[model samples]
Target chain A: MMSARKIIETIDIRKIYGMGEVSVAALDGVSIDIEEGEFVAIMGPSGSGKSTLMHILGCLSRPTSGQYLLDGEDVSRLNKVELAAIRNRKLGFIFQSYNLLTRTTALRNVTLPMVYDRTKEFTPEESDEKASRILEHVGLGERAHHQPHELSGGQQQRVAIARALVNDPVLLIADEPTGNLDSQSGEEIMTLLHRLHQEGATIVMVTHDSEISAHTQRTIHLLDGRVETVVKNGKKKPGKEKVEK
Target chain B: MKPIEAIRIAWEAIAKNKIRSFLTMLGIIIGVAAVIIMVGISAGTEAAIQEQITSLGSNLVFVQSSFTRGRPGQGPQSGGLVFDDSTAIQDEVEGVTAVVVEQYSSETVRVGDVTLEEVEILGTTTGFPSVRDIDIAEGRYFYDLEIERKQKVAVLGSSLAKELFNNESPIGKYITVGSTKLTVIGVLKEKGMVGNTDYDSRVYLPISVVFQKFTPSFFARIMGDSVRMIYVELDEDANLDSVITQIELLLAKRHGVSLEEADFTVTTQQDIIETQESTTAAFRSLLAWVAGVSLIVGGIGIMNIMLVSVTERTREIGIRQAVGATPNDIRIQFLTEALLLSIVGGLIGIVLGVGGAYIFSAFSGMRTVIMVHSILLAFGSAAIVGAFFGYYPANQAAQLDPIDALRYE
Candidate 1:
């Protein structure tokens, strides 16, 4: 563990809701470390603060107290614009609802992240080319022009995954990425995540399913705003499919 | 984000809600159209007045013979300018080019069993043609020789000729005025209207004949050869103020009185035109303000609908923020939508406004002039209205918190 390069570090972080007498602490006195290129799953009950921790790690919220360091830089005090910049350039997010813009073609939806990255200059044609390539990588090259409603549930999630990977982000944060999918689609998404993990991608997924937890390299379980246990699982078989790059 | 990308996003949103977008722009459309039409009418009134004045005469200085209110009983010793004063001004004034005396009488005119009663018969010297810019459509205007010879000849305005002759040539024809038969030698072309004077519907005769035929019946013969008004034309390079002062002093000296007691009012055409223009300008601004109120109301409508749109798209805004859009970016996107709506509406309003002005002129028989400044003002105001009214709603959208907006029901 000492030889591994740390990518995310939290020192007794806490997030409190409300103020004075009627306050509730969503995350309290929690500390964890995630190393580079590691796939980890966060598990907890409904009110156990796993989602709060994910919000903090993804730079969507600032901790109420203590420190959060990402890639060896303190991010707890960053401003909204700075946080947005980090999110655009370094973090990718996938939501349970597969939040792709309605009425937009798959290729255009995937190109949106690059359009918001102000630091990089991309012409419309260049963004279009890059988006199409990413779409092809996700096996949706034929569905590039299809709108969100035209695609099936599994196909829409695949488009969302392509959007998440368009910016080549450093960390992929997924919250119940397969929650709305059919069982067969869910297995395909899990297999896709496992495949990316073996290719040296850093991933953090939040889910309560133990069956999903078995696919990750390590798991962190939370109980009542604090870390309960950390476990290593190697039960799932490796995916034999190779990516075409 | 780049501005073009923001515009594209705004266009997409507007295209998705085509009916709502058109409804939002309708207010601006009506406002802009009203503004243009008002301006057109105002400008046309000014042009019509200027044309009417110029048609009466060029550089005309009018000396009106207002009878003095003498002390009751004293026989009112000829307290008005007589026809000799017209010759005096023509001879003595330095910049004076010509002077013509005008007197009028209403009489029934008869030509071949068709009679027009109470028709105006104007009297003037042959200077009428060059000084008044009136053209002869048929034969030549009667000149100095005709007037000096006291010839029983008359020139009919083209419309008068049409009424009496029914399209038959009026030149070399005879028309009787009050049982005094006269030959129509020439006809004036269509000169339209000047103030209440319809130049085309009137008849013209020499001052000698008008005085002999009408002035002998004057009240108790107290006014002998006294003309009602005198029109003086000046050289093109002459200063109007100087000419007016010279005539005032000359008339005072000739009548054996001081300038104030001269019993005549001398005025330049410029003074009359200025008075007309000032009145028209005030009316124009009043109409413009009334029209501008509609534009402001339109702006308020835009703001109202924009607020509703922001509320409806709260989740969409939340998703954009989560995907890394800044507050400024959100503001620009919504602002772009509003600006596009107003600009497009303004353009449509311009076309409608100009067309409306044409229709008004055609139906009402009044001229309408569309000035370029009015169009630009209407367009520029619409853009400002969109941007100004759009600010609050766009700010509301930008200030939204990602967490609350994303979780909103």
Candidate 2:
């Protein structure tokens, strides 16, 4: 019987920036394993390479030298078209800037990924319906027709999240998802990510705040293009807490 | 994305900036309208020229006497072939139908109560009306007997009659030509002006009467009753070249010279018509070229506006790109917007151009005609210009870097 795992492993991943004399290593010899249905957060300061590791894991960028097996398939050496396909099918991205089309409505923003996924056959009406439902799930159902400029920053970020989830991706990768929001809006977005994780969706988020990382079941700390440590929270095994303590 | 969604997005973008879109389309409108109007004017002028040429009778040929050199110090010297050359043509040419002789001189005339100013007086034979394709509106034309007897009879052109008799009929009344009193036998129908010359304001009489009464000394001193020119009518089935050759031979034999020194130039009316058509065709092509330049300028204007629009929407392009839109989508969107602008402008321009042509024709009394083929050409060229000029800007928009564009304010 096969194990139902959303991700397999990463081995000796290295990413270098620039070339020749001015080269800088953004990620060096980084490796980690993430299992199915886990909410993990990567914490690091500026220039610590957490964003570079997240980009490699999300298939947004390629590793200079590494092995990354996503669902037991080697994804490190994939070509551009194959990487795009993997990004479309398995990875969903939530940006810190909330890059929604300015003049377009929330529903249209949500339906954009489905437009790029040409192999999936859905009529325009069905796509719109699915976009509307996802917007509703993100708590922007009534604001489906509102343009990005008309919505608040937090509401716009939620719309971006809805757009990412509309493809039903297996791994949700967010980079500084709530960095630009107020405390209340940031907490709300984290709660939304927590709820999505509880529904058996695998999530990997990058942030600089320890308090934000505390909401996840596991935290990975990185320093100077290397992973410092990985810590599992006590809640992962509530029944064995007394024995372990 | 579905085509309908792209169209909707384009329309929304256009609606957002209505004034800018309209301003961009104005160039196309003016270009198309200018093309239609210029072509209409040329067509009108060509039609007018053809109508005038046709009215002069296409089958009639003119034979004018040529003069050899006389001394420069000689006063009022005259040398030309005589009326016998006309008779020779009639007798020798197989295609000859009717030959008429003409002598024209400006002379003062008088009636009962009014002494008219100097006007053109044509002296011709009884076959003048048939050869020139003119009709007598009232009374009868002079017969051959009248020409042979040297009777003083005249036919008044419609305007000449109006000038001499007012509203009263002038047939049978006498009008003085130089010193001879001639009786009016008929009134010619009204003929409009051609090439700014008034043909209806003239009088006609027999060549015999004019030679006997007005210029007796001049005619007697010349070879044999010489006149200005002779007009010949040919059978419709006869070859014009053969007839011309035979007439040239007869004229050369009669004038005692070779074909080159025959002292006459014979020209068919078809030659005049052909010359006029080519001249008008040249003018029409010139007008079309001027209009084409305007259309090119309009195309450049579309390109300028599209470049501006692409620059203005760089951030929007970046946002779309970030949301997984391919470069193709960006290209198609901008191209569709430009196409819609030009097509709508072209349609409006066509309507205005046709309306302008009709209005010009009605108000200015110029015959303006709009051809269907010209309209199609204008419309098709406008679309091609739209595509050609809109392509570069749209490609520029499509090739923009998403990362750099997002950084643009």
Candidate 3:
């Protein structure tokens, strides 16, 4: 049994890609639950629907049929506008490609999430202070005014991470966050994620590399649109077991 | 997102491709400029004509023969108004002030040994000074008795007197005109050309002298006693239209023709002004239609470029959405870009338009008046074009599925 506090819960989620003659099941009958303050990595081969699951968890998409409880609310059937509001307030996303606006300064990119955060309604000055703080936290304080092309790939990804954290979201979802980085930069990013996790931030990362997944507290592996196994790296609580699948 | 933030984003996009953006705005610039210049020149012409009409003496109307519109060769040959028609209008029509009749001929007049051939001789009555507004700079005009007695008296216009006597006062002196000697009674004041005809270059005489004495006997036998034109001035409280109707009815009855078939045309100063104004207005409207088409073309140009921009920025859009931007935010950003382009273009066009109007007036000597209303109208329509045309592409950008957009290569 896991902890009483389940931060994310999905009941028998099914996602279909086409219909009838050419139908393909992207994620078929998968269920998962996560606890607060957890660092987990989802791993799978290319056709195994790991990305589709990550998209659903990030509130970027919805499953064809499911019951998803994010912070204990059924959000699977929420409209796109409602999902976008939730994403702005509660979820932060880091994509594989950095995805920073090319012509904008790094500080502006960091402040972008706050621009759409209607619930918090941070004024420009307040948002600027928060963005600068996050940029310094990501170790790119001096590069705040530099455009994306002026920075290296690693620096751009650092800026993206700062943007994701600027809103103080509950769930930090990173989809192949270090996928495009050099080995040295990738290790450095993993160290940063580990540091964030130590500070009690809930993080869900998607990675196919076993060596990378080994650094997480738990590794959930998928095969043929189903959870193959859940590997624990030996930080077990009482009455809780690994490999729930 | 706030509008200023959206405007900043749009500015970045525009600055990325400056040349392309300017080219997209070219049509609007030309359209606005053409509209302003056209209206300016036409309005200026109307003002100038109105001034000329006011100078043509107060409450004046003109009567002339429309000989070309008469049945073929009948008008100039025999079918036209005579001096008797002026008398009839004066007698039969109410609110008559004075009717000045004119008869013109080219004749040789000798003051001394110098013989000036082709001196234009105008035969008019004593009402010439009052009705035609010609002042007597020296002596007096020929009176009614002089006209009735066919007296050989003449009034020299200021320029004609200068040419004939050269510093010598010719009043009360005898000048031989077409084999008949006439006493020069007055030196008329200067009146410059109203159009191509120089009103200051003619010599005035009594109508009886020009009709019964100056013209050859052969001309009298063929053309009979004919009058060239009649200038009529009205009383202060006269109803002009009613007087015109009375004159038309009396003339048609005397000439044995209906009003439709009458060879003479009566026109007031206002009538001539309206005809000229409508012509200029028609030309202006044509130019406006062309300018309007150009503006539409400019709007289409904006839509085309924006659609291309939307395609190019698909990845950017997806990234924005992932960072919690709503579709409305993306739409506003693109729309702002289009509005900026059009408004900036309109402003430049205003500068060009006013400059062009002044330059045209300077080079062509044609008048041009630029009104504030035209500027506002051009700019307002340009903004409307921006908003209207920008909607579709902005909506296309907004309605893109985030997942699919993100996956776009």
User: For every candidate, what share of the true interface contacts is present?
Assistant: 0.40, 0.21, 0.53
Model 1: how far residue B403 lies from native, Å: 1.5
Q: Which digits, one per residue and each the tens of the lDDT, describe model 1 over residues B30-121? A: 88999999999989989999888866777899998766632212444455777888998999898988888888888899998999999999
Per residue, candidate 3 scores C-alpha lDDT tens digits across A1-245 of: 44667788999998999999898888988899888888889999999999999989988899999888998888899887788777887888888898888889999999988888777767789988889999999899999999999999889989998988888888899989889999988888887877777777788999998888877778999988889999996644422433221
TM-score of 1: 0.87
Q: Please give the ranking of all candidate structures by lDDT, highest first, separated by commas.
A: 1, 3, 2
Per-model lDDT: 0.85, 0.81, 0.85
The better candidate by lDDT, 1 or 2, is 1
Tens digits of lDDT, candidate 3, B72-109: 24544345767888888888889989898888898998
Question: Which sections of candidate 3 miss by over 4 Å?
Answer: A1-4, A235-245, B72-77, B102-219
The sequence of per-residue lDDT tens digits that candidate 2 reaches over residues B1-409 is: 5676577777777778899888888888888888898889889987887888778775888888766533212443335646677777888789888899998777888888677777888888888887777888998889989988988899988998998899999988989988888899999988767777566888888888877766565445546777788998899888999998888887766666677655677888778778878887898888888887777788888889989989988877766665555677778888877777787778888998899999989999999889887788888888888888989998998888665665567
The model with the greatest lDDT is 1
Lowest summed lDDT over 10 consecutive residues: which window, candidate 1 chain B? B69-78
Docking class for model 1 is medium
TM-score of every model versus the real structure: 0.87, 0.81, 0.86
Chain B TM-score of every predicted model: 0.86, 0.87, 0.80
